[model samples]
Target: MKNMRDKNSTNSGFTCANCGRTVSPAAKTARNHCPFCLWSLHVDSVVPGDRAADCRGKMEPVALFQKRDEWTVIHRCEKCGKELPNKCAPDDSFEALLNLTALQQ
Candidate 1:
């Protein structure tokens, strides 16, 4: 079996699947979504940074929610219909987050 706690799990940059923008890795945490469009991929099965999923679907930013001071973006998979929440990155577009927040209200 493969090592589950491998240190080789890198926080690498990737091209946005939804917006086609080049995304850089986050400074404090593993970036699972695009900071430009706030879109993500269904790559993790149960936890963050665990690339154990095989869905490979485009995750659409559906809603925004807050817990105290921090905000999170809820992404829904287009192919598998799974919903996941990712914390907002510092470099994420404030305008886009506002738009999602407005839509939720």
Candidate 2:
């Protein structure tokens, strides 16, 4: 049910809107969202690290998780029907996780 890209990232470098940071696709660039903040630019396919889709949808973190020896966050785009799991950075929003849990209940 996940629309994943089979190719590597083709686009690199952008001014991050969340925290005024610059990002570029790199071999070890495992970050999909801003490390300074949880907000992310509209990029990538359903899965992070792949840039094979043309949706150009703004991804917003709706849920957070650090489960089963893994760290992941759930993203949903308002412009598109794409939803997928992305890797969460250590600087991710703890408040966002709380908000998600509160909304779930």
Tens digits of lDDT, candidate 1, 1-105: 133233366477788889999887688888889988899988887886777788979999999989999988989999999998888888999989988988888
Query: Model 1 off-target regions past 4 Å?
Result: 1-7
Candidate 2: list runs displaced more than 4 Å: 1-13, 18-29, 95-100
Model 1 Cα displacement at 47 (Å)?
Answer: 1.1
Q: What is the lDDT of residue 1 in candidate 2?
A: 7
Instruction: Provide TM-scores for the models.
Output: 0.88, 0.62
Clashes (N, CA, C under 3 Å) per candidate: 0, 0
Q: Write the per-residue lDDT of candidate 2 for residues 43-65, one digit (tens) a residue.
A: 66655666656776667767777
Q: Lowest-scoring 10 consecutive residues by lDDT in candidate 2?
A: 1-10
Q: What is the lDDT of residue 74 in candidate 1?
A: 89
